[model samples]
Target chain A: MTTHNKIDPLGPGYEGVAGKELRFRDVFRDTLRAEMNRDQDVFLMGEDISGGFDRDTKEPLDAWGGPFAATKGLVQEFGPERIRDAPISEAGFVGAAVGAALTGLRPVVDLMYFDFVTVAYDQLLSNAAKSRYMFGGQTRVPMTLFARSGAGTGHAAQHSESFYSMLAHIPGLKVVVPSDPYSVKGLLAAAIRDDDPVFLVNDKKLINLTGFVPDEDYVIELGKGRYMQRGDDVTLVGMSYTSVVCEQAAVQLADAGINAEVIDMMSLSPFDEDILLESVQKTNNVVIVDEDTPRASMASEFAAVIADKAFDHLDAPVKRVTGPHSPVPYNKGLENAFMPQPEDVVGTVRNMLGRD
Target chain B: MEISKEKLEWMYTTMYRIRRFEETMLEQTFKGNSMGVTHPSDGQEAPPTGVCAHLTDKDWIGSTHRGHGHCIAKGLDTHAMMAEIMGRATGQCGGKGGSMHIADFSKGMLGANAIVGASIPLAVGAALTAKYKGIENESVGVSFFGDGASSQGVLHESMNLASVWKLPVIFACENNGYAEATPAWYSVSAEDIASRADGYGMPGVVVDGMDVFEVYEAAGEAIARARAGEGPTFLELKTYRYHGHFHADDPKKYRKPDEEEHYHERDALKNFEKRVTGQKLMSAKKLKSIRDSIEQEMLDAVEFALESPMPDVEALYSDVYVNYSNPIFGLR
Candidate 1:
């Protein structure tokens, strides 16, 4: 039940009211508050989300506000009925969210860590994803499963890993991975309003990262890609946290006199194949940067799509800069090596260009 | 809690409807007239009928794989259920769900889950939705599962949630004496499955599943408590399944030779018939007419299912999502 009296202003990315720079987490909380206020049907449920449970009193106190504080001050605004604090039961609560969505409510459920999805895999895949099709279109599960992903936080094997690719493989799901505060606000709003099941994978590393966002509610359409920077030398496709890495890599490429085009693939399932193909046709050389492991990754899918549709337009073989095919290490040094960095993307793009 | 003549009559008819529907499906599957697998609730009608009789379209119920009885009790159209089992486009789920996944959201039957204990959480969610909406609606969510589901962690989790939140839900445990081929005595360590509810801070009651009146009374009390915002109640209906786990299964391989006969003597339908007649709540002639009508209704359902057309190829991709083209490569 903690409260911040100071009014935080908009961040730097967007052209909006001049105010304080908002972090990705603050933007997410604000977006959720706006959505909850806009639609009475919208509600949230997850472990420690309400931050009501007090360890000392053994009674619900007004604050723990979720593990990451993404839902801070929400219980006070919406009350406990709308801002539910669920027990540590992933399968139970996730299944309940699907059922609730199917009936009449638009629920936003938290998976805590993206890796915890394995525990509720059946509910997400079988019940939530397949229910509409299996039931012959009789119902729709309008729910958003939100979770924090990426390996940089050093949460170790169980907590780390970006498995949005696995969820994207399912037919009925819409997967969104936003890299910054602006995209997080817009994409999360869109997911909440979607009539189908949407997975909003927030990068754990980007929680404290600051960016400019609007003060009002807005939606960025799912499956659309945006160009962070454009050039004809080569196209660098990055998703989620890796998009930030690509921005850095593009800077390094620019320093070496290599004009590179950077494309952020924010949505993975209803991915912008047209944008990828058009970019590859223009640049002829492409390097895909992914935070997930390389094998059967979204990068692999994009590479295949490129080879299949834009093979004749290629100047050189497509390259993939991704995490290695191994578990995310717990040690900071090993974990850093386990994940892809800007230098890896820079070197991959330079090598693709046949430059030392 | 006084049982009226009309309510008793409806209960008898509801039980008869479930029995006839399941029996017809069983016979059809044996004759190769039905598509996919079927889990018949031939001898287990009282629990669903009694429990669902207390519910309405505003209330929701989650069912198990052996769910035809629950669907009927929950007020789903017999023709749609039959068509669904037969994989016809006219079915409730448009032929996609088949037997194991039959659902009619319009009637608040939240579909039947093949995975044991899966629907418990779903019912809890529905109850949470009702609670969130406020108590003026008095809406309750009912979840029906087998004894096998008692072992699932979800059941405990859901119960704890329902209890803690005081959400309006009824955890109906239909202990049909077995979890598929394994006997409940072997799988469930507790002497009574109802006792497990004590751990979750809720009322635990066991009802005679063979007697419809007993189930009706117990379910009524639980439903009342839920509607009054007293939280969830766990009702363990001591029942039995006359047939195998599914139509294709052979019960003899796993059960005693006389087990079916032993349970059949106090069968739900038979006991209901005897009690209603003895109490003069309904005459034998009236019960006969009700039974005959249900029989004809089932016959018509089977015919409708047989005559209905299979779903079109275009429907293969429909209903996967409200919008957005599936982007999985090669799936299209």
Candidate 2:
């Protein structure tokens, strides 16, 4: 199912500049620095962000003392005033960011890891997401909440679940889950500049993955999907880190003489439905893969929608490869069984192909 | 402090309005004439009114779920507010946000949040914006939450941040002795919520929440200090919830038989009447006339709400997105 076709995703007839491979963490820091350098309104706030160095001492080791080092060296460049460290209060600081967004400053708040979002869900959903609408267009919350999500590493339950779908359920929130370094830099830069509140979910696994990105700053428009691979047999729509899994499965499916198109849905809310529709219409079949639990997952929502819109065009019923409807287990093997693996994606593609 | 006759009359009238409005709302809820959640500000009238009494149009107040009193005190259109509580189209927020989320930002009434302890930082943020924008007049913000919210991490963090930045935010804790079903005594681990203000290096005060004059004086000092750029203040308003946390709930099991009656003995309205009449600040007849006018206004508000039409079906998705020009996916 791995079919390589030339597609101009940057634009028609306009070839964008490309650079050497860059790590996802470096991309985040570089993109944040670039945006902050360009716009003074953009600032970073969270626990240990300003401290950047020593963790055990909890003192200002140098600049970036954040646990993840995602905000490394930001304090020195922007100063401690712009790069603030709160007292481990996500709800307070994040809610204050929402309030700040409504007034003037474009704050980029970090939750360290995605699991800490529970402490601030009320602010994220009720306050930031609903502020513009609740105020009857009197205000706008242009804040960005960046957090590391997913559980490839043994971080356990509190920090592992991909709750992107939960946020997508809310109307005003824009959820961005970038799978690679290239998309991370572009999409994060975009999220920081977007007028709406964006929940940018970064995967811990992809933080070390390298990809080619532009030397200069760039912006990837929100609500648009990028087709990573082109095929004619079946359209495969993947989200976040799961998109990488789809690519691997596509390779395996190719060895078995199957061709599948892959579409990486970077932004979950206000999804690029047109891309999904166009891909499904071209392939005449669809397989949706997601890392989230199958029940009420984004894949389920996409499948239902594609079935309704492109049912007549389809040669086979849509299939979804997602995590089981159970908690992500603590054991590595059990957790692997619970999550959607590349082999599961290959099996799903085979099943969909067999149905035709 | 010598209060003017006009101010005394206004205070009396404000208390009467809150009492009558909550009474009417309780009646509506009892008769099953309401829509969403309702947490009456029945016994907690004096905190909102007392604090808001000193606020001008430039200042802002972030209220709690029990916020009808705050809305009224902040000069919200009673007819529209009442209409919103009934989920009518003519209400504030166009009936989209009901009792727990009523808001009129133009009047400096930042929407009443349903989530506990959520609005404290919002008020601090707004105060920060006011200070940063360099508004010529010193505009401050007030955050009104329950005693339960003091236990929330946001409450403590926000107070610290406000102090660190010296933002013009007044943290008003309405210690009604209970947060829903949980008593503050069991939940709060501090001597008093205000006592923690010292850790944040801010002035902490306790006031008789039922006494309009006491709350008024305390709030006035804090507001003046904040406006002068001195810093934030923590005011713990000690009051008692005379009604059930919400309408149609049983408070009988939670309190002694005469607990409500005992608190009612120190009714804010009665206290104001005794003080003003005894001091000859305002005539009892003059206060009665104001009350009569407010009662008539409330009756008219009820009429307006009842007569108002239900929101159109299209309104369900109207305010969901601020600039959502196209709703391509209309499940309805």
Candidate 3:
């Protein structure tokens, strides 16, 4: 998903950019700071974003800087007024975020963990998502919400989740999944600027992974997926961390004398179906990988789209490497089994190619 | 609490407008003109009329299911409201939102939410915006819910958020005594919902919903305090609804005869008329003229709604998002 400095998403005439290697957490924080500096209306609200307040002075301590410290050092720079910390009440704050967005502000709320979205699901789905449509286009809820998601972390069932399909299933809301440092930078900026409510699901696995990030203010368009590697043997589709899994599988399969093209569907809800379809149309074999549970997953959705639109091009039936229809456990081996790994996609691709 | 001659006239007209609007809307609902369920806010008119009387178009208000009164008080056109109830393209929300979801963002009326206690945070959010922009004196947030919504955790959450941030918000809880068929006595844990405000650390006042002047004065104080950066306030307006929860619901099934009689005897509109005429703040003839004018407005609203056309099929897909990259809604 890293496109490098040559292609600044701020688009054209702004080239000669420098590059640096940074962790996803740093990129997330830097992007927040950049957006805040760029737009005065942009503010943040989340539990533990500022971590703690002094007993007497009530100054932000930035103790934890939120889970994974994704928002570290932001409070000190933006001040507590702009980088506001919220209470444990998810529904209350999320609802307030929607209202704030409606009333004229770009509110980015850190929902902590993806699984915690259920607590405030009504506000997200009912007000933030549906307000514009339901109100007959009277208002636009320009809200951006993010949270850590994925099963590889030992957060157990309550904290680890990739149920973005539940959000993607919604009509009005937009859902984006950034794979690495590069994707997070561009996508976060884009999500913040987007007028509609966009939920960016940050996989916990990618938070610590360092990758190439351009030293340019840019935004990768939402609903667009880029080709990581182009091959004709099979098209491997991935989103969020699974994109990383697909890239790994593509490398492994290439070593086995098999060529596979990897497509990272950055935006899930308004998904980059064309990228998947085009890759499938050319490659004739496709394998969709996802970390969410199997039933009604994004992998299945991509498979369905491929099957429906590119049936003639398919030399083999579309296969999916997805998490089992079970909760992610805390056990190391069990958690590993629950997520769609590089080996799983390699095996599924091999089976589809009849080369195993 | 001092009432000016012009302000008194506007209040009287606004209350009468709400009263007639509800009655007319119900009549249209029974006449098979309304597309969906309609929640009549006949008896609980004073809460919105009083609170909104002090508000300008810059101030924001979040409303509940029974939101006709709030819409009328917020300066939404009756013609569009009627058309919306009738599910016409000319409605406030282009017929997409029925009676429960009509909104005019230009008027700072956050859409009327259908889910109980769902719109509380919206008002708090609006106040957050005002406060964020450092415009508290010019804009404030007001949340309108019923006794049914008093128990919702979001209400408590919103109150705490407003008080902590000292956002310019007013938590206006209309204690109409019934959430659907269940009475507040059975559902509400507290003796008075306003008492819960103490826990949230905001001043809580119980007002007579039947008296427009009382609601107006109390709301004025709260709104002023919010505008003055003093923080949020909780107002429990003791009110009642003349009709059932929805258009077809019959109150006789759950409510006792005396309860209905008691509320009707102390009707908000009747008391407003009596008060104005008794104090010589307004004349009986002037009040009658306002009533007569409202009667004609109701007739025109109904006629406009009946004559309006249904929305195009494409409208179903339109307005879903400001800009969705995907063109088609259905499957490939």
Best by DockQ: 3
Give a tens-digit lDDT track for model 2, residues B64-182.
88889988888888898888888888888777788888887778887888888888888887776676666514578899998988888889889988897788889999999888888
The DockQ of each candidate is 0.75, 0.39, 0.90
Model 3 lDDT, residue B133, Cα: 91
Query: What are the clashing pairs of model 2?
Result: A1-A253, A1-A254, A51-A64, A51-A65, A52-A64, A52-A65, A53-A64, A53-A65
- Model 2 misses residue A78 by how many Å? 3.0
Model 3 regions more than 4 Å off: A1-17
- lDDT per residue (tens digit) for residues B1-332 in model 3: 68889888888889889988999998988889899999998888888989998999999999999998999999999999999999999999999999999999999999899999999999999999999999999999999998988888898899999989999999999999999999999999999899989988999999998888899999999999999999999999999998998889999999999999999999988888888788888999998898899999999999998998999999999989999888645754
lDDT of each: 0.87, 0.81, 0.90
Taking the tens digit of each residue's C-alpha lDDT, what string does model 1 give over A1-356? 11111112111234445445679999889889988998999999999886666668555555778879888888878877788888888998998898889888999998889998998988888889998888889899999999999998779999997977899988899999998887888888889999999999998989999976655546877887878888889999999999999888889999999988888877897888888998899999999999899889999999999999999999999999988989889999999998889899888887788798
Q: DockQ (C-alpha) of model 2?
A: 0.39
Query: What tens digits encode model 2's per-residue C-alpha lDDT throughout A136-230?
Result: 55567888988888877888787788877888888888888888877887788878887888889997888888877666556766777788888
- The interface root-mean-square deviations, each candidate in sequence, come to 1.1, 2.4, 0.6
Tell me what TM-score chain A of model 1 achieves: 0.93
Candidates 1 and 2 compared by TM-score, better number = 1
Which residue segments of model 1 deviate by more than 4 Å? A1-20, A52-60, B325-332
